[model samples]
Target: MGLLVVKNIGLLLTMSNRLAIADAVVVIKDGVIEWVGPSAEFDLDLYQDCTVIDADGGLVTPGLVECHTHLIFAGGRSDEFEARATGVPYAEIARRGGGIAKTVKATREASEDQLFELAVPRVYSFLAQGVTTVEAKSGYGLDFDSEMRLLNVAARLDKATPVDIVSTFLGAHSIPAEAKENRAAFVDDICDRWIPEVAQRQLAVFCDVFCESIAFSVDESRRILKAGLLAGLKPKIHAEQLARTGGALLAAELGAVSADHLDFASKQDAKALAEAGTVGVLLPGCAVSMCKPDFPDPKLLQAAGVKIALSTDYNPGSSVTLNLPLMGSFAMAFMGMSAMEVWEAITINAAAALDLQDFVGMVKPGYKGDLVIFRGADPVGPFYEYGGSKVAKVIKEGSVVVRRDPCGGVTI
Candidate 1:
C-alpha cells in the first residue's frame, strides 16, 4: 500500500530476452513497479520513506501465473481417476454415470458457503507454490442456476484472497443426460440463454468449450464461442485433448486467445495457431495422470513459432494437481522442453494465455508488483526441485502476502 523497495537480489529472471540479471533493485510505489535495474545505481534519496526488503542474495522472479484450472466443484473424482488410469474409455465412464456428471450432482447439492470453503484451501495450495494469478472454470455446473452460483462462489473467493481469480464460463463442457433426447435444445439453451446471462452479469472474463469427441461438436463449439464473443467475452477452447475434433484449426480461424490441451493437434494446427498468434497450452500434468501417449509436440509447436504455455489443469477427474513446479519438471522430461522453455511457459507465455501479459508477467516499470523470492541461489531451483519450494517470500501488489516458515511451511 506504500512505497516498497527490494534490493540485493542475487539473480532475477525477468522473462525478457536478456532473461537474468544480477544484483538487481526493484522499486514499487502505490502497488506498481516504478523502477528495476542494477543495485549499484539504486538512488537512496528516492526511497527515504519506503520499506526496504533485502533479498539476502537470493533468486527473484515474476510471480507464477496459472493459465488453466477447474478448481470450482463440489467433490473429488478419485473413482473416475482410477478408472481412467486402468484404461477405461472416458465416454463409457460418462455413459455409466461416473464422470463430470457425478460431480455436477454433488455441486448442485452443495451450498455457496460449502463451495467457497472447498475453493479457499485450493487457493492456498496454489499460492504456496508461488502462483499469484489463476484461471478457474465453471464446468461441473452445466445448468443455469448452478453455473451462476459457481461463478458467484469464484467471485467470493477472489474477494477473500490475494491471489487474483479469472473466472471462465464452461457451460458447454458436457451435455446433460436429460438433454440427450434433444442435444440441439441444450446447445441452443447455452447459446441463447446462458452466454447472455453470464455476460450481462459480468460473472466471467472468458468462455471456453470442451471441443472434443466426448463433448461438443465443431459446429456446436463454434456457435457457443460465437455467442460468447457477441456477448463481449473472450473465446478459448479445450481443443484436441483426447482426439482432434478440428478444434485447433477452428481456434486459429477465429483468432481465439488460446487452444488448450493440444495432445492430438497436428503440425498444421500448430502452424495455424502460430500464424494467428494464439497460444498453444500444454497440460503435461494431465497427460502423466491419464497416461496419455500422444502428448503435445512442444518442439514442433516451438518451431512453428507458437507461444507455448503449461498448466496444472487442476481438476479432480484428470489432473489432480496444483503443483506447477512438478508440471514444469514433467514438461521437460516428457514434453521435450528445456528448463528455460518451461519457465517461460508459466510466466510470459502463460500471461498471454490470460490476455494479461502487458500487466503482470514482467518485472518492469509500470507492471504490477507481483514477484517470488526464493531462498536458493538460482531462479531455477523452484522448478528443479519438484514437489518442493524454495520460496522465501511472495509479493502481490507490492505487499508481502506469503512468507516461508523455518519448518518449510507457508504463512501469511
Candidate 2:
C-alpha cells in the first residue's frame, strides 16, 4: 500500500465526467491516487522506489462496482432454470415454493463458516471479472437468526477477500412459510426487532425490501424502509421486477438510494426517480434468466433524466452470473444503451447507487487507487466481446490482487 505507479496506459477512462485519456499514467501513494495524467508529463526520475505496473498499452479504468447482489446464499436453483426453460413462469414457480424460499431453506440450514466458504470462490469470480467492490445483501435468511448469520458471513467475506463487500439488510426479501398466516406480525418483527438489532450491531449500511405482489405490499415496504431510516440505515428497494405494484413510487417518496429491477416501471415512475435522485438499477440478467422479454427501458429513464445503472443482480433464484461485462453487453444489445452508458452504469453510476461515489467510482486524485486493466486498447472491448474475461489485471487500493497471464492462467 506504499507508492505504486501504473504507466503505459494506452487508453485511460477516468469516468470523471466521462473523460478518456490516451497514453496515460497514474501514480498512487498509500492506497490513494496521487496523480493521473499523460505519461509524457510524468517525472520518471521521481518516486524510483515505487512498484511499477506496466499496463502494456491496455485499457485502464476504475475498478468495476457491483451494486446489487445476493452474494451470501447457500444453494443453487438450477432446477428452476430447467423449469423456466420448459415455459413455466417464475412467479408460478415461486408460488409453488421453488424460488427464494428454496434458497432461504438451504441458507437457514447452513452454518456461518459454510456460507463464508461458499462465498469466497464467488468473490474471486467477481474479482477475476474486474469487480473490486460489491453490494452484497442478506435476504436468503428470512428469520432473525438466519438473517444475522448471512450478514455476519458478509462481514467476514470483506475481511477474507480483497474485494470490498458492502453489506445490506434484506430481511424483507420474502415471507417465510411459517409467517404466511400472520404477515403483519412478521412485518412488525422486521420493523420493531430486526431493523433495530441490525442497526445497533452496524451489520448493514442499507435496508432493502422486495416490494412486489410476490413480496411485501407498498405500505409494508414503506414501513420497513422507514424503520430502517430511523435506525440510521439508507433505503433501497426491489421494485417493479415482476409487476408494477407502486414500489418505485414508494422508493422515490422515501428518497431511497436506488430502486432496482424496474422492468415494469412507467415513465411517471422514471420522473419520480429522477426528481428524487434515486438510481434505477437495471438487472438484465434476471430478464434473460427468467426468459422474460421485458427489460428496463434505458431510453425512458434517459428521457426522464434519471440516472441508470446496470448490475448482474447475482442471486440464486433468478440471476446467477457474476459477469458484469456480460450484463453490460445485455444492456447494449437489448436495452438500447450505448457502450459509454454501459461503462458508466457499472462504474461511477453503480457507485452512486451504493452511495460510494465520493470514494471509489472514478479514477481521480483523492479517490481510492482501485483499477482494472483490460487486455485490449479499445475501451469498449469488454462489452463487445461476449464471453470470457477481458481483464488482464486488477488492482485494489494500489495493490495488485488479480493477474491473468496470456495462457488463461490466473494469479491471485
Candidate 3:
C-alpha cells in the first residue's frame, strides 16, 4: 500500500486532550491513518507514488457525524411551518390534522422509489455540511407496509449517497389514526409483525420508540424495545421530549444505547442515564422549532457523568433544517454547552450513539481516514458563521470523495 500525506495543517483537533493540537503532518495509507508527527520528521522519499494534499494552514478534523436524523421521508411540512410562524400552537395543529400524522399520510402514500428519490438531495445537504455519517430513523410510517417501505427506501438511499446511513426502525413513533383506538394492537403489530420482518431482513440496525404521552406509554415502550432486542436490534428511544413521563428512566432500565429528546429530563434521569451507560442525544432544533419551554440541561447530565451528543433531528413536521453546523451552534448557544464540548458531542459522542465511535469518530492511527477540512481555523466558526462557510474538502476511507475550492472549496 502507498501513503497519502496531508501536510501544513494549521491546527489538528485530535480528540485526545493531551494531543489535541499538533503542528504535524498526517500520513494515510490504504484508507487508514498510518503516521502522525511533526512535519520535519517526514521522510518524503518513502512514498514516491502517494497522493499529497496540502492543508494550506487550514483546520483538519474528523468528519462531522449527525448521530440522529429523520432524513428518510417524503413530502415537506411547509404548511405546518407557515402555521407555526403565524403563532399557532403545535398541539393545536396536531389536533387539527397536522404534525407527524400529516407526514405519515404523505409518507404512506408515496412509493418506495419516490421516497428514495426525494431523500437523495437531503442526504447531500448533510454531506455538503461535512457530515459523513448520519443515523436516520423511519417513524413517519406507523403501519406495517409503510414502515417497511420507509426502511427499504432508507437502505437504498444509503447506497445511493456518500454518507454512511444507519437506519433505526421507529415503528412506534406514533399510533396512526386507524390505530388510535387500538393502541395495544398497534404495539402488538410493531413487536410481532414489523420487528420480525425488519429484523429478519436486516433492514435496520436499531429499534426506536417514541415514548411520549400521545405515543407509547412506558410499559408499551418497554415491551416493544424488548421485542426488538429479541429480534437482534439495539434499543434507542425518544424520551422526555414534551413532558417528563419517566421515559428516560425506562430507557436506562432497558439499557438503551441512547435516549434522545430529553427536553424535560430531570437530574434523576441524568443519573440513571449515567449509571446505565446510555448516551443522551439532545436536539435543540426541535426545541427551537416547537418553541417548547423545556430543553435538556447538558450541564446537569455532564455533572452526572452522562455522555452527551448533538443531532439535527431533521424531519418535515417539527424540524426541517439539515444544517448540522447550525445545530452545533444552537447546541452551544441555547443548550448551554461549550464550543469544544459541542464539537465533541457531535463527533465522538454522536458516533458512540450509533456504535461507530471506534471506527469513524476521531483522527488517529489505525482509525478510518474519514476527514473534513474547514476553511476557518476552528470548527466553532462554522456554527458561529450561521452557515456561511463551505466545507473545504472531505475524505472517506482514504479516498478524496469531496474536494472543491481547488484552492479552498470542497470538490467531490
Q: Estimate each model's TM-score.
A: 0.97, 0.98, 0.95
Candidate 3 stretches with Cα past 4 Å from truth are 292-294, 406-410
Query: Which scores greater on TM-score, model 2 or model 3?
Result: 2
For residues 1-412, what per-residue lDDT tens digits would candidate 3 score against the true structure?
Answer: 3567888887777664525555667778998887877777888788688888887777888888998888777777787777777889878898888888888888888989888888988888788778889888988888888888889987897888878889999989988899888888888888989999999999999999999988889999999999999999999999998889989999999999999989888999999999999999988888667655556678888999998998889988777789888877887777778878887887888888998878877888887787777776765676787755557878776777776674545455
What lDDT does each candidate get? 0.88, 0.93, 0.84
Candidate 2 per-residue lDDT, tens place, 68-151, comes to 999998888898988998998767887877988899999999999999999999999999999999999999999999999999
Q: Could you tell which candidate, 1 or 2, scores higher by lDDT?
A: 2
CA RMSD for every model?
Answer: 1.4, 1.0, 1.9
Candidate 2 wrong stretches, greater than 4 Å: none
Q: Which of the two, 1 or 3, has more lDDT?
A: 1
Clashes of 2: 0
lDDT of 1 by residue, 3-46 (tens): 99999999888887746889998988999999898988888786
Error of 1 at 154 (Å): 1.4
Q: Give residue 111's error in model 2 in angstroms.
A: 0.5
Q: If the candidates were sorted by their TM-score against the true structure, best first, what order would they fall in?
A: 2, 1, 3
